[model samples]
Every structure is written in C-alpha cells, then in structure tokens.
Target: MINISRRIQVNAQSEANGVSLNRSQVWEGLVSKARNAVPYVSAITECNIVEDQGDRFIREVVLHGERLQELVILSTEQQVEFVRLSGNARGIIKNVIEEENGELYLRFSFDFSLPGVPAGSEKELEFATGMQNSYLDAVRSTLQTIRNKVSQ
Candidate 1:
C-alpha cells in the first residue's frame, strides 16, 4: 500500500479574497452540493446520507469510473471552529482554525492510502497518482471557491 499525506493551510498568509468565513459556513457549502462545488468529486454518482443530525453525519458515496468504491464518510463539526472528517478511502481530512497571537488560520490535512502495484508499473502508478492528485486538486479548488463566495 502507498500512503500519501498532504497538508493545505488557509490562513491570513494564504492568498484569499478579503472575506472571512467561519468553519461552519465552509462545511455547509462543502456538503450542500458536493458534486457541483467540487469538480473531481464528480466521480461520486450517488450520495446517501444515512445519518444526519446537528453536527454529525454518516454518508455513503458511490464512486464510478474504472473502479467502483463505496466510501462511507463520517463527519463532525466542533462548534463553529473546526470540522473533522474521515472516509473509507482515506484516513481523515481535518479542517481546523488556529488562533495564535490574535491571528486566525484555516488548515486542511488529507491522509490516505492507495493500493500499491509492482515497482516500475507505469500504468498502475499513473492511474493511482492521477486519481489521488485529482482529489487533492478538487479540495484546493473548492476552498478557493469558498473564499470567493464569502468575499462576494
């Protein structure tokens, strides 16, 4: 298995429009219309919210294409400050804010594991990397859109 962990930070130092949105607003926008908001996640043909309450949810997403994987995602919000999420496909993606010295910061960490193929397997690695990179890019793009929306 190949494990990939990536961290993306969205803080005052991050390039964003002059808009500040709490973690709740960001989480809402992310889940409300996931397919429309995130591009690469378009692979998710179906999403069933099995359990939905105030600050917690268990959602199953059916992914399509060359492979079919049902990702069961568990998500929880910590008040309005942060959100924690996990899925069968990945370890967890945590979106949290850090308040240090009167400065607010937003951060996202993605940790996941992928099936590994034999070394020097061009096709397999290519496909694996492509899918992983697409997911990562989608999140980054979504965050940019969120910032734009809040600015407007």
Candidate 2:
C-alpha cells in the first residue's frame, strides 16, 4: 500500500485578525462547508475528528465524474503539511498562502499514489494527476463556501 497525503495552506489575514486559524476550527469549517457543498462534497461524505491521531484529520469524499469512480482521502498530520489523496489521486497543494507586504496568502499542496502501480508506469501517473486536479477544484469550491458562510 502506498501512503498519500495533501493539504492547502492559507495565511488568512482576516480584517479583524491575522492569527492562524486554530487547527480544530479550520477542520470544523472545512467539514461544515463540505457537508453543504453537495455532489462535490455533499451530505453523505465522511470526515472524522481524528484522522491519524496526534493532531491529524481524515476527509473522505466520494464523487462521480471524469468517466470514472473517484475516492479522495486527505490526511493533514504535519505542521508544514499537505492534504494527501489516494487510490487515483497523487495529492496536491491547491492554493498558496503568503504575506506580500502585509497581505494574505494561501498555498495548497496535493499528492497521491496508486496501489499495485508498476514501476515506471505512466498509468499510475495519470491516475494521480487526474485525481489531484479534480480534488483541487473541489477544495477551492468548498473553501469559498466556507468563507461565505463565515462572513454571513
């Protein structure tokens, strides 16, 4: 079995505060946002309180598109971390976060690997790449929803 993980980091500078969002808070917002997003995330998805034990999380989403069945699992267990996806996705950093002369920035990371992938196999790369692209899009949509809900 191949180990996969990915994450999106955002140096969110809220108009009211510039502190990093508490990890648990961020995860909560993510799960809430995803739950309401539908199809891309929808109500049927599974997100857990502890994904890997020790300040980590697990978000599993089942989506249909790209002419294939897709399953995405993202594990954020490290500080300088990334959300990892597996099965058909390589994992990706979808957004970039940074402070440019006192401005907010976000950096997203994505990565993944397929089980039983033969060495030097292009098919494996395809699976990982395709999933990364699709999942990144999902994350972006989900984040936007979160932001909107929070501001309201």
Candidate 3:
C-alpha cells in the first residue's frame, strides 16, 4: 500500500493579481469538475455522471486510458469527496475549501494503493512521487480553470 497527500493554497497567485475566489465560487467549480473532470484534469479524457442524487452522485471517468467509477459526495461549499469504486487506484480523494485569516484556500488530498505493489519499495515510492506531481498540477489547473470561468 502506498499513501500520497498534498495541499496547495488556491488564492496564493490570485492575491497578487487582485483576482480571488470566494468559498462559493470555488465550491461550484469543484462540483463542476466532479461532474465532468475532463476540463480540469488533463489525464481524464472522458467523464460522465452516471448517477445523480442531489449532493451525491456516481461518475465514470477514463483516466490515463483506464476506466474508473467514483462516488462523489458534495458537502455544500465545504468539500467534495471522491471515493474510487473501481479502478487500479482504490481510495478517497477530497477537494476541500478552507479559510485562514479570511483568505480562501483549496486543499486536495488522496489516499490510494496499487494492488500488487510492495509498500515502501522503490517502485512504490517512484509511483507515489509521480502521482503527487500529477496531482499538484491538477490542483493548479483546477484553480486556473475556475479563475478563467470567473473572469469570463
């Protein structure tokens, strides 16, 4: 089992340009990404909301040429959690909106494992590192996408 986690401050760059996202706007963007991640995640080539139940839904996405199903739970403007139901990756990924000193921040975290990979082995470490980098880019892209939408 391998575990990777990280968080990036969403408004860090926006603060310099005088363009910032509030909690609600960020939350809306999160939900939109959850419904159809192809726009936010570069690796996700296809996305479809298979099931919808208000704040909770099931989505199917093709990520890196692999098909995956995820149960998405939305906690209003606070957080969005994606639990992988089927795929090589098995775990929970969360997009959370937080506030510190009245400044908004977005946090992305994930816990997952490859079925046959030995924990703590070099292979696992290498994979984790790549995944971490990919996820960091995804976070930055998500924020940028939201910023673009807000500006439009």
Candidate 4:
C-alpha cells in the first residue's frame, strides 16, 4: 500500500476588521454545496452528495486530470468542530476548525493509500509517491483559494 499525507492550516480571520471568524458558518458554507469546495480541492473537480442523513452523507467526487470517480462517507461533528470523510480503497480526509494562539484556523489532513500495492515494495512506493506528488501544486493552489475565498 502507498501512503500520502498533508497538513494545511488556513487562517480564519476577517482581513478588514481582524475579527474572529465563525467555525460553524465556515463549515456550513463548505459543505452546503460540494462545488463550493472544488476550487479549494485541487484533485476534485466535481462533488455530489449522493446520500444524506443530517450529520452523515455519501459524497461522489470526480478527480481532476484523470477523471476518476471516488465515493466517500462523510460525517460531521459540531461539538468537536471537525468533519471526517473516508473512502473505500482510497483514503481519509479530516478537516478541523481550531484556535491556536487565540487565532482561528482550519486544519486539513489527507491520507491516501492504494489497497493492493505491497507496502514493503520500494518501487511501488516510489511510483505511487511520484504520481501523488504531481498534484501537489494543484493542492496548494486549492488551499490558497479556500483561504482567500473564506477569509474575506
């Protein structure tokens, strides 16, 4: 199996007034429409929640470039201010609204793995890492877009 991970911290403050932002509002806005997140997520060009049950749902997203489809189970926890999504054979993504040093921020972590690849195979690991690394720029751009779009 190949594993990939990244942590992105987004500043959540009003640029004009320097006021603290609302976590719930940001979360609601992000999940309200899957397309709203497309700009912030480089790999996913399309998002559709196929199933919904209040705090839990099934989302179908189309990956960019390759045009692959991935299905994920998503859950929200308002108390902890976090949203978690896991995909079969793909990986897991976690987004958390956090306050550090009295400043609000959004922390995003994504872990990816290929199910069938042998974990000990160096060649496979290298190939997988190279494949995922190609999308790094898109990912960074997506995060920047999210931070800019929301922090305004």
Candidate 5:
C-alpha cells in the first residue's frame, strides 16, 4: 500500500482578500463535498447520497470514470473520512481541519492500494505521484470553493 498526505493553509490566500474561512464554514464545505463532490472534485462527474445517518452517510460517486461507493463519516468540525467500499482504490481518505499559530489548515491524506499493482513497483510509484498531484489540486479547489461560498 502507498500512503499520500498533503495539507494547505485554508486562509493563506483568502486572508489577503479579507475572506478567511472559520471552522464552521470549512466543516460545512467538507460536508457539502461529501454529499456532492462534483463541484469540489473535477474528477468526480457524478455524486449521489445513497444513505444518510446523521453523522455518516453512504455515497456513490463517479470518479475518474469509475463508479465508486464510499462510506463517509463526519466528525463535527474536525474531520471527514471517506472509506472506499467498492472501487479501484481500497482504504480510507481523510479531510482534516487543523489549527496552528491561530491559522486554519486543511489536510488531505490517503491510505490505499491499487488492486493489481505491486507495492514496490515503478507503476505503483507513478500512480502514487499522479494521485498525489490530483488530490492536492482537489484540496485547493475545495478550499477555493469554500472561500467563494463564504464571500457570497
């Protein structure tokens, strides 16, 4: 399995524009992404909430042209976790909110393995690199979307 982790300061750019996102705003954005990721994730073409159970929900999303089902769990304003139920990747992906020196940060972490790829092969490394870049863009886009929402 390969693990990829990345984080970005949510208010880094927005603060200069006088639009910093608070904990609740970021949390709501995370929840919105969990429900309908089409806007936040460019790779996700479609999203549907299969089931809702207050703090957790099951969603089916078409990501990178592959239909995937995820069990999404919300941890109030702290974190949101997506566990892949059926997809090319297996394991969990997390979106976490952190505070440091009075600044807010959003962290995206992935722990998963491609079914047929060998752990220490070149192909795995390539996939990991590409996924890391793709996810980083997604995280940035998520924050930008939240900022736009907050400003409006």
Candidate 6:
C-alpha cells in the first residue's frame, strides 16, 4: 500500500477570517453542493450525509473503480470543523483545518494499493495518476464555485 499526502496553506495571513464561511458552515452547505456535483465526482456512487455534530459531520461515500470495484468511505469534519471526503478515484481527502489568527490550512491524502509483482502494476499507476489529477481539479472547481457564490 502506498500513500500520497499533500498539505497546503490556503492563506497564511488572516486565513481564519479569510474563509467567508466557517468550517461547520462550509460542511453544511457542502452536502448540497456535493449532491449536485455527484455526476462530476469521478467515481463517487453516492454521498450520504450521516451525522452533523455542531462542529463536524460524517458522510458515507461509495467510490467505484475497475480494480477495486467499490470503496465505501467514512469521512469526517475535523479541526476547524472543515469537510473531509473520500472516494475510489482519490481515496481520502480532507479539506481546510486549523484556522489560526487569520491563516487557514488544507490537506489531501490518498492511499493506493500497489499491485504486488512487476513492482506495482502499470495499470494501477495509470489509474492513480488520472484520479490524482481529477481530485485536485475537482477541489479547485468546488472552491471557485464557492467563491463566486459568496462574491455575488
């Protein structure tokens, strides 16, 4: 099993206040947005809202792939109460977290199973690469949509 992790600081200064919507608030709206965006979720079968605990929430999302077929993910809203998500294409991805002063952070991590023999099958690598790019693009599009809505 090989894992890939990416952590970025969206805003290093005043990121806390920079996110027009609070973490929990984002989670609230995210559910609907995700539902509407399901078709674009790559391998997502469904995103079922499970729990909302004031500061955090949980969801069960099913991801599909040729090799794994389907992967059920349990995502949670973590620190800062930001949204967390998982799926087949990219595995698990966590959104913004740990707001301090005015700074905000975002992290996305994924776990990919490398087929043993032939040193990680070539097909697995191709899927991983495609999914990784798709995940990043999806996040960017989602954020841009949010920003546009807020600006209006």
lDDT per model vs. reference: 0.49, 0.44, 0.86, 0.49, 0.91, 0.48
Ranking by TM-score: 5, 3, 4, 1, 6, 2
Worst 10 residues of 2 by lDDT: 65-74
lDDT of 1 at 55: 49
Model 2, 35-119: lDDT tens digits are 2336334433444332444333444543453212222233442222435443344443333333456543334555445556884
Error of 2 at 21 (Å): 12
Model 6: how far residue 145 lies from native, Å: 1.9
Q: Candidate 5: where are CA atoms >4 Å away?
A: 14-16
Off by over 4 Å in 4: 1-7, 12-22, 33-36, 65-89, 123-152
What does candidate 6 score on TM?
0.52
Tell me which of candidates 4 and 5 scores higher on TM-score: 5
TM-score per candidate: 0.53, 0.47, 0.93, 0.57, 0.95, 0.52
Higher-scoring candidate on lDDT, 4 or 6: 4
TM-score: the better of candidates 2 and 6: 6
Residue-level lDDT tens digits of model 5 in 19-63: 788899999999999999999999999999999998999999999
- After superposing candidate 2 on the true structure, give the runs of residues whose Cα lies further than 4 Å from its correct spot: 1-44, 48-54, 57-97
lDDT of 4: 0.49
Question: After superposing candidate 1, which stretches have Cα over 4 Å from the reference?
Answer: 12-14, 30-46, 50-75, 78-120, 148-152
Regions more than 4 Å wrong, model 6: 11-25, 33-36, 39-93, 114-119
Query: Per-residue CA lDDT of candidate 3, range 44-78, in tens?
Result: 99999999998999999999999999999999999
What does candidate 4's lDDT look like per residue over 53-118, in tens digits? 655556557654443333333345232112224333365555555666765555444555656666
Score residue 65 of candidate 6 by CA lDDT: 34
The model with the greatest lDDT is: 5
Tell me, by TM-score, which candidate is best: 5
Which clashing pairs does model 5 show? none
- Please state every model's RMSD to the true fold in angstroms: 5.6, 7.4, 1.5, 5.3, 1.4, 6.3
